[model samples]
Target: MLPTFAADDYIELAADLPATLQAAIERDLGIDPAQYLANAEAARAASDVATALRAQGVDILGTSIDGQDVTYNVADEADAALAEAAGAEVTVGPIELLDSGREVQPAQDHKGGYGYAYQVAEADETGSFPLSRCSVGFSGFDADGNDRYLTAGHCGVDEETGEQFTYPVHHIELSEPIWATEDWANEFPGPELGEFVPGSMHFGEQHDGGLVDITNPDWTGVPQVAGWAGGSGAPDENSVTIRGPIDAVTGAQACKSGATSGWTCGEILVPAQSTPVGAQDVTGFIFNACLLGGDSGGSVVVGNYALGVNSGSTHDGRTECDSWVPATGPDDTTGDFSIGYSLSTGEYNALTLLGSEWELSVAINTPQVTSPEDGGQTGPTPTFTGTVEAARSTHRVEVTVDGEQSYEGTIADDGTFSVAATEALAPGEHTYEVVATYGNHSRSEVASGTFTSTEVQAEALTVESPTNGQTTDNPRPSFTGTGQPGATVTLAVGDEVLGEATVAEDGTWTIAPSADLPVGERFDATVTQAFEGDSQVVTVSDLGITAAPVTITAPEDGSTVAGDVVFSGTAFAGATIGLAIEGVVTESSERVQTAADEWEGELVVGEDGSWTFTPAEELRDGEYTLTATATLDGGDPELTSSEASVSFTVGAEGDDDGGELPDTGSSNVWMIVVGVGLLVAGGVAIAIRARRGGSTA
Candidate 1:
């Protein structure tokens, strides 16, 4: 009989947990301790009901607990009502079980070890090539205590030979050769393996596993699993450590680390399921978590316990239902359902292969730091916190700071511990290392990090006006901010100096640019404050200075014109010239034209940022407007430019002068000559009249 934990025990445990763990349990998992205990009890009751229904010959698919609700999947609606009456939520769906097949070939190349994915390639006598990619299941020892790696059995078998064979297993990182030794296959039975299976399909009878020799000195063997909390494909300093294997349970949240997909999690739908693939029947755990082609043989885990190895995934025709689909496969596929063989079954198979005397286990599960991250900077005094997985074994965790200052603590019931530096040290670079010593005096690998400490007093600095990401047309914008009193504030864009200011007694400072900023330019206003001997810099990025819109004020709208048509507009400094036709084309005979008349012209903006459009020829009798569009190149799209227009009408042919008037449109000189001729004639007529009047007197 197993020991039972009461509700009060859970509440006490929750209350005694560290602040970090409590926050994680509540924020990430969304469940408190009392609620968790109640849900567990409800799940147990639902399981008992399921067992009783099975005894009564009820046709049931499966049962699992989702949150506080105990859910039962059934093939018939009548069975759902029966389950609901028995205090279980019911869902109707097909039993659609699936099995493991050979992993698919890789599409791209990558390199990693342990929980990382790898490719295995082999060529036959006909020069035909067969390739498959799979992840390393776990690192362990065979019955003879020989160091080895485990993976899916189908990864090492050849279809041509229909049997297991030795082949070179390539690691993504190392150039050295790693070989997979054909130790065992689940469906294929060796002469010695028959005794362990006998007639039982639930045990080693349908196991799918293989082993790789890892006695090479170049390879490092650590009891860590990659892709914890959706990590990258490459295993780095943040990989999770495996505590040990645990029994698979339905409705339990499970996650797997694969080479292609990194880490993914879902609930276990069926703990023990017999599924059929192409021509083989595989018995394993079924889950809804995403699995892809290159994810085969990855580790499946629940919390800190290593549970199983990924085999394959199901391909149902409903691709829209799941969050992910295989990178390379058919479309409209709904089934991301995956299957994994339990680690216990793989361990038993290994024992059967090498003899029952050997034991398979993980080595040196170390502690990890959760606060004050590696290569980070902190103040003079710092508190350190981390977690360690020592199972039920007694162990002492020691944290060493700067190789001199040391603090020791014991692992908690939930595998968490914290320690604080006893004294504040002088400002400098500091290092920390955490080590765990077991009851037998065996020490784990050290987890170490380095950080910098400074003694400068902290001060607040903020930009109070024309905030970050603001757009304006003021070229010499004023920047105001608050900083430490008596501090010098220097503002710059990249390496070019904008201006500087000194903080007043009230801790307020302002800076105005010495010269106008370029129109439509975006830049970061890097503000640096220096006080005493310490200085800090803050950057306000994406500040924009927009260009003023072009405005045509020279040619008034709806005015009449006869000749020398001129269009003028004002725009921001350095803006480019742009023109557009704003009206329909009118014949010379037309008396009036609206703004819809066609108008066309182009001109360069003056150095003063003003533009004037002057037609080289005389204007015809018509109405038109020239629309001017000015654009500045440096600002965002929204502040680029604005359109401006002026409309006027060309007077009739004889409205200003007689139809016989000389063509003065050719040149200004011709118009000047015609005006001089009229003046001389008038003067001659006036002289003659005065002479005649003198004769009459």
Candidate 2:
């Protein structure tokens, strides 16, 4: 979702958050920070339209926010047209003040949008102290360089006992093993991370916050925040670097990671000074996200900057964050909002409350170039890759080639970036430099490198695989060799084109002939790989392929015939033919049937490459299968074909014409037998006709 062209949130969002943080934002919220803000803006505009129409007494059914489209559902198309004309897409929806939003009816779980909400708060501040817990927000340095963390001030106060209650801040390595389960805060008491500052807390009508003085030696002065997305894996929850306070913007996305609810993100419905029912006239802003009872004191952030501390939520009855869901947008009037105490301008600004001399941490490191060595040769459009400070949010990278053409890309969460030139650089010695911009608009030192561009100067093609004189059994053999990537490689035999392949990214090429080459025949082929035009060709000579598989060519498989039962096929000259028979049976009597036992033998192939063989005995009038396998006289395993088989029946499908009859020489015998059978059939027919009193015409 894109914000309105006039909205400043988009520009502010792009500038406020670093690329790594932006990536994390999208990962946790399931909404681009810009889109989340845009949705809010769009929803706000739509709400105004709805209110105006309602004032005119227009009946609005409901409202929805999808991307930048804010719709108002009307009872009829007449209202739709009117709403559309008023600048909001017609379906219907709203915002305003709250009377104890925390005590309002539970928020509708099935709200509009699919944005993710992190349920990361730990103990419910509403829960009785000693048994309840609150979440830590951000870390900072005190006037004496002492490490300090901040949370909601009301979280440390025990309203029940009113003794200024302080609870142990258990320290656990933020990971799935220790922090994934909801009850792990109580189950795994790793260690004491820090201590709540004595008398350094406040919960007034204008502000609410507290500071936790860091006692752990290793964690002092660290500028990191706990980032979780309500999952069983991924320490993504431990990410997010807080670079001090930044004023919050209405309609922008805000997130908080807590032990009670992992990580929930939503849009700010109001920037500040909103009246709500709970804690009458509480000093806070309203944001639409899933904040449970224990979320109080959890850090609320907009981009990479610290915004506020979670105070409480309207949906305090919810137990768990079911999944990442979208915000209801800023127009939501249904008391489904959470409160956060301002850290930038409120009376409880962390800086003033902690120590006037306290300063937030900011880190920036120079990026390192790891590709296109100091003075190496590379293709014109070489890809540049490098690394930046791993934990830093290096968002943008720029690479200039020869101080001319430049390429840019977003840095990844892992603090690495890659940019490939869109066009070829001028051929010759060129100096390239890379620069990265990360957190708090910190720029990395220009990482420079020197390289010579080959332009289109491709290396001559080489046919190394054939190796001058090579032979194989592959009828269509493939050729392999190295060449410059991005070049087209061609394989040809004389003027006849075989096939072509492009040189792969690994500087290699492979091609094979489209059709099988003649067996036992040797020839030379030319291969050329180049850009723009053909380059010098490398010839692969004395390359040959082996013979074709033996093929059966007699009696056409599946044909029925009564004859001498001969099998014929073609094979390599001087090869031996191993013949095997199956499914053949002969019946000596009608009462008994006998199955033919294994019938197999070997035959010598003739010099002409064609062979014919006849079984020593006649086959019965039944189906049979004959298999002929050819074995090379002394050929290599890579130079021979597989066996061939055919099936035929010794009956009506064929006669002596296709196969010779065992003892009979001509068709005269068959004619005589037919003439005798016909005479006997006529006499029997006349006798039957006389008995039935019918004519025998």
Candidate 3:
């Protein structure tokens, strides 16, 4: 059972280990034991699900059990159609586990091999005859520093076209092959048979299958081919094979191959069936796997072992396999012939074909770098140069940095280029490609290099977002700067630190505010290190504030009172004033006096306290302050009156009204009540007494 059947197990697997290791490891090993257990459980469930799907004849790419990814070869719709058309039954197998294992080379006994078919220039051609889909395959570099590969003998025959047509086949499962004049078939030996690569081979057939090199290429991963005959087409030469290890090979077991009838696995009736081709008399062993017209030259393997290469099969009447030859046809009722040549024979043939004339060796060497490769340099920009060697120095050469055109110098009389780079490059890592060219022949090599400079100082910075003291409705403003392109820019607001962002090639950046900010109507926008200069601070004024001059019209200066005192100021519209007493503040009050000025409201004075009128509101006062502030709708602010404080006592009134006197408690309440009540009551009493005295006299 796989570990990651359920979503929970899948997440646990990721949490348990690094992402890269997860693919190579099935067992979870980490601090969280539940994660591993959950992965295992999930894998079981997923395996079950995948089994069900395969039973339904659905093809699955990859699945997970416990905590690892799983792969299932469920019969897809196409497979079902093919099976129904052939009237054959199908079934799925158990989940196979896989992980990282030691790398090893393929044994000579492996019954599969690969070779190259070179593309030669056709006679009637202009500039250069293209290979179209054809290219060369290399054997890669062996431990001995020699690189050998294979190509068609005809490809090297033409003097002009051979060198020009030497190009690597992309996405092909083989080593990069360079063109060699020696005949790989005879005079110039080709790659050894049974070699493996993590790519697929195309033989201009209906199917395309890529084989994975488990031992070589360091056990490179292979992209899943839906089934045999579903991947790349197998060649007619029977040169390539996909083999599972011996333990994986099973007799009478169903196997797969890249051929016409993909995924067709027949019971292995006999290990080796000898048969002969008509007129050719080439007798070979026949396997249980049925073969069709396009199944020629395909590798038939069990698990990871290569058993044999498909040769050909007798055609059944009406596109149906004969039942007589169960090993050769879809039906055992009809007569069919399923035959293939053993790899042993192919290997023997290869040894005889790869004579001593063409030396076959492999090695891994660093490709040449055309760009600069130096360390610890400053001031002057560096230039890079190099050359590559081939058995034949007459081939044309093209050098490039990062795949782009850097230098296209040809191989000189000495078979190498001694030229300068086209541009003055900076310090960093660069990928270089060396392409050999001769008429129509071309092969490319890739290498990398790094440059460094310690003398260059970072340039100054400039603000791009908000200008000096620019207020924005958006609390989070994007801080932008102009400096070294692609350089990391550090930003901050007030005392809080903001994160850094890398500038693009163009000097421009955008960032959100760090966190919640103060609610003040105005703030100081301090942009520092914006330029070569030091730092600068600019204060953003209020968005809705103005300033104007105001005069205190009521409550004369230095006036002492125990009751409410009306202190008014003159200023523009929206002007306001507040009373400040001993650092205590009262609510601001406003009253528009004119278009140019406004009169502020009154303030209350208390006993033994200083009093002054401000914008608005009454307040208790040991001392009072008058502050006149004017706000003219989106205009500059004006402080008309400075802070004014005056002290007064409530006892001077001597009202004898007891504690009921309003001025006795908080000055704010007492001022309004006592100040207004005293005047009203005294006036009413005087009127009543005057009427009574007038009547009696």
Best by lDDT: 2
- For candidate 3, write residues 1-697 as lDDT tens digits: 2223334544643343322222212321222323433443333334344445546665543332213443333345575454334333333432232111211111000112232232344535564433322122122222232233322122222323323333332222322111221222232122222222212221112111122122333222221122211222232221222211111111223233432343344433332323333212232343444454333444444322333445445544212233424433223334344544333221221112332222222111233644445333422233445565421233444556556756655554334555545454454555555555432312444455444523344455666666654554455667666665555555555576665666566766555557643322344444333221122333333321112344455555555554455554454333333332221211113311111111223343222122334333332232233333333333333222223333433223333232221112222222211111111221110000000001110
Which candidate wins on TM-score?
2
Question: How do these models rank on TM-score, best leading?
Answer: 2, 1, 3
Evaluate candidate 2 by giving its C-alpha RMSD to the native, one decimal.
22.9
lDDT of 2 by residue, 588-667 (tens): 23322222222221233578567765444465554566666666645544555468878887765422222211221222
Q: Assess every candidate by TM-score.
A: 0.36, 0.38, 0.24
Question: Per-residue lDDT for 183-206 in model 1, tens only?
Answer: 112212111100111111121345
Worst 10 residues of 3 by lDDT: 684-693
Q: Against the hidden true structure, what lDDT does model 1 obtain? A: 0.54
- Name the regions of candidate 1 deviating beyond 4 angstroms: 1-128, 174-205, 315-334, 345-359, 363-390, 393-697
Q: How many clashing residue pairs appear in each of the predictions shown?
A: 14, 42, 92
